[model samples]
Target: MMMRSSPFWPLFSQGIRHRVLPRSSLLTPRRTVKTLPSFSLENKTCVVTGSARGLGKEFLTAFALSGARGACIDLSQKDCEASIASIASQVQNAYPDDPVPELRAYECNATIESDVKSTWAKVVEDFGKVDVLVTAAGIVDNVEAENYEYARWRKMLDINIEQGHFVLAEEGREMLTWHNIQGSIILIASMSATICVRPQKQAAYNTSKGAVQMLAKSLATEWGPRGIRVNSLSPGYMKTDLIKGLLENEGKELVGSWERDIPMGRMAEPHELRGTIVWMASKFPTKPVNPA
Candidate 1:
């Protein structure tokens, strides 16, 4: 940032220097804060579910931008194709020379036990070992609690809750047995795990997130000693594609309430969550590894 002499600065400083005015009498120039450069995530193989669009797509891009080999997984092969093409194009433009990323698409219904097992087995086969797993794929539907269909409720629970468990369990087993080092498992949790979602009734979604919170802590404790770390992130809403329409429809007041609830004054952007995800995935850079 270039600093320029303000038209009034010399006059104001002259006043202060001559003891005619206090230093606070004039506005001071503010220095621009420099942003920290991104670190290398090269050689890390990460699996991000629901990479076809929205939050998932953002996560996939972030992983690639950070120099990691990424696997983009979603239910539809067509969606994955579009996602892969988009990511490839974006990375190629960004990096140009070192642009060809080791990213592939996979289709798996995370809710099914058999599907998770096969999908993870293939993930390991292709990537060698899973260093980081970002479980971003999920669905949300809001309906009056009393009139909520049982099938819909069950579907929410199975996909959001059971599916997370299956993926973690499958990957955890491999990381513990096949791999010699610890790995990280990050669950894309929501503030609903602690705070209640008002106005609309999403009892099923809330409950599923609540269950994930426990699952994360339990797995962390169980695997901590074995060099594997587990943690969950509960992010407030951001301007993701899924919620963009709602925010525009419901107006900013509905989103602004979260600022009142949390210390931050607004919802988190998808990439804003990236720092925490990477930190939790890898061991802390400055801190020594826990031998326990």
Candidate 2:
């Protein structure tokens, strides 16, 4: 004969069900959802190296439009001043009712460690604290490896690695630490770091950018625990002043080849990266997400 079920069997089943399923009040409604964090950079101070022109200026302009006080660092004070003025004018025109964030020009040769340190000191003194840094100061050369000179290669690494990226990152880290601020650092790497671009023999340039990507990873590991975010932004071919001469003259055919290689059939415009720059500078990501 089958044994009779315990009288408490229904209560035991109900208890198990109660433990497994959340209470009605504890469950979130289907319509309720987490909202995206604001990408606004209001009241934040930003520093952009190589901000006089090209991709650097584009990043700076994006920061300015997002309501960040900007420090435009370049090799030429005159150029930085001019660029900042132009950015300010555009920002004013775009937001007629809103106050234009303060933008300052600081001349700093990024390839020189002393200059970078001194300039960073000034930036900290002026801005009180730096919340974001974008190292866009770098050089690219297309010399065939077979005939590449030692001096040229050394210069390429010096500008793109030693002083350009590492030194600036170190200084920025110090400033952030001193101010007890958890900040963002964006290293402007290149797609060439991972892919070999055709029609260009830039062994030195490629090596430098590869190092940059690695540097970002290394720094992220070291600084993440310190609440500092380090990431690399590897943009592909872009229509910027760095390649204006090449695109306009001898490298016209080269540009065509680059465009064909690109899935979109054209190089990117500097302004096209504006939204990306702002988002990266914002607190949304909160963690490092290096993009190649």
Please give the clash total of every predicted structure, in order: 0, 0
lDDT of 2 at 272: 95
- Over 58-93, each residue of candidate 1 has an lDDT whose tens digit, in order, gives 777776666667777778756776786787678768
lDDT of 2 by residue, 1-292 (tens): 1111111112233222101111123212222113344687767888888889999999999988777788888877668877887887888787766566767777767777677776676667656788888989888787889999999999999888876564556555675557767888888999999989889889999999999899988988888788888889999998889888665655578988888888889889999999888888888877888776
Root-mean-square deviation of every model: 18.4, 20.7
Error of 1 at 250 (Å): 5.6
- lDDT, model 1, position 20: 12
lDDT agreement of model 2 with the native = 0.76
Alpha-carbon local distance difference test for all models: 0.68, 0.76
Q: For model 2, name the residue pairs that clash.
A: none
Worst 10 residues of 1 by lDDT: 1-10
What are the runs in model 2 whose C-alpha is more than 4 Å off? 1-37, 169-172
